[model samples]
Target: MTPIARTRARAVETLSLDATATRNALSSALVSGLADALTDCGKDPEVRAVVLTHTGTTFCAGADLRDPPAPEALVDLLRQIIELPKPVIARVTGHVRAGGLGLLAACDLAAASREATFAFTEVRIGVAPAVISLCVVPRTDPRALARYYLTGERLDPAEAVRLGLLTTTAEDVDEALSPILDGLRRSSPQALAETKRLLTAKVLETFDRDAADLTALSARLFSSAQAREGMTAFLERRDAAWVV
Candidate 1:
């Protein structure tokens, strides 16, 4: 099956991350598939809004260590979500970690189930949340991000909302999204696009200013000895040497 599955209802299109075996990790293939899907949705006049969701217990586990997408590709994917003419909403019902938080941050609106959890696990993996910070830093509370980014502490959905990582959280995420989706469907496409453009201006500026630097930092760190050890330890189900 394809990593991404698309479905449409009314004026909204949903793109589900269907790579359950990888917990929808951002493999090169998954990144390409999603980018292509978003392009199609953007060109479709009927797609007033897009919902990005996942199909497993984990929404996304971050970069696919074994088959990771290029840092540039990941950056492009995140920017694509932010720059899409239609509003991109995230519908998460499970764990999201590391680079996965990038996807959430890039979205125009995000609603997660009460059971959902999030973390910036990059620090633990001997890298930083470099590229994702383009959108994340602009949207979230700086203080809150400092704590989570450094410590990789788990955040509940409500905390995620409070920190601005999520627009809302509910016991029933789909129920919570109903009104928002309906509102989008009723809104004029041009108005929606202009409104989204207004909202994402700062985010896009961040991408333009820092994306190159961050992408380079990501590539550098991922190739470092520390990252190699961290990734090896993670794959071996053991602690990295630096773990104390």
Candidate 2:
């Protein structure tokens, strides 16, 4: 099945994470599909902006344990979203976890439904949110991230907004995004692209500086004994040995 479904409304192109059976997990195939879609949008004259959304109760349940992408691939996908010439907006109306947060952080703007939830669950699985921190750390409030990243605590939409993980939260997410999309449509393509570069320059710099180290750390940790135990326990619907 196609993991990404593309649709358009005038100048706004929407790319949906359509792998509902996996809760849109970032398997290698889904990552490649999304990257290719974003690449096409970046070069398309009619696409002034892109909306990245999902089709299940979970926006993304993080990496697909059974078929995880290479850490480097995840890093490149996040960087691609940040560097895409057309603005990418995350429209989340469901739960997001672990590496999924990286996707949200990479977007130029994000809006979520009040029912949406978020968490950095890597710690619970004996790995750290390493690769994602490249975008997540710089964009979110450091103090809030410190708490959530360490504890793997769940955050509601309002708290996510307070932590700078979301642009806004509304009972109807699409209504909230309508005006933003309208404004994007009215703006000049060159002006929007230049302004996005200005906004994302700091983020791109962090990626350039820390991506290699973070990807290495992620690869090392995911292959660790602790992660093996945690993943096994999780698959078995039990707690890891370290859990008290």
Candidate 3:
């Protein structure tokens, strides 16, 4: 098992991202491990819930772009997380940025430490927050989306809760998530699954109608010289010389 693939059991199955120094960045191994964990948990009647947490201080820094997975692999892992039959809780502690924020959004519920911070930071790095955007769009407030997506500013836990990114702030990581797990334990697993299905269907209904348009827009953005320039400038730590 790679450093990224680490699992421990609390009362429930606790899957911790083990890339601590990298702030538990979503490396390919970690993504695969996470998907597998969720699949296994879904099959186990004994596992009432899954808690997705990290080993170190930080929750997750975001995707490990340095060793990024193929787009298909990335999508598959994210879909597994989103579609898991059992409830998944995001146990956020430190900073959740870019794709990390998206992971939190993908979970059925998120509990963050009062000190945790979040950001939709893809714009700062020049790429659109494409995959995570699908997860975040429905969860976040429409009014705040434009600013956060464009500016890539960090939002504190309080702000994250206000914007629906977090269920609530915890005094500490364990305290924040204890009640959520307790509540899930007492609830009907079958009913939870059904509710998740219903909510997912409703949330996806809006995008199902506009899929083609969205794809075309994304393709155009990717093909543009401005996008290339922005990306290059970000990587080089220089200003982008956009024509317009």
The candidate scoring highest on lDDT is 2
What would the TM-scores of all predictions be?
0.99, 0.99, 0.84
* Candidate 1, superposed: residue stretches over 4 Å from native: none
Local distance difference test scores for all models: 0.94, 0.95, 0.74
Winner on TM-score between 1 and 3 is 1
Mind giving the per-residue lDDT tens digits that candidate 2 earns over 45-151? 98999999999898999999999999999999999999999899999999999999999999999999999999999999899999999999999999988999999
Candidate 1 on 191-216: residue-level lDDT in tens? 99999999999989999899999999
Estimate the overall C-alpha local distance difference test score of candidate 1. 0.94
- Model 1 residue 35 CA deviation (Å) reads 0.3
Tell me how far the alpha carbon of residue 86 in candidate 3 is from the true structure, in angstroms, after superposition.
0.5
Which residue pairs of candidate 1 clash? none
After best superposition, candidate 1 residue 60: deviation in angstroms? 0.6
| Per-residue lDDT of candidate 3, residues 1-244 (tens digit) | 5544434454378777888867787777777777777788889888778888777777877767566554455555656766788888888778888878878888888888888888876676556777666668888898877888888898898888888888888788787677778888888889988888887774455345544454455456545777677757755888777423
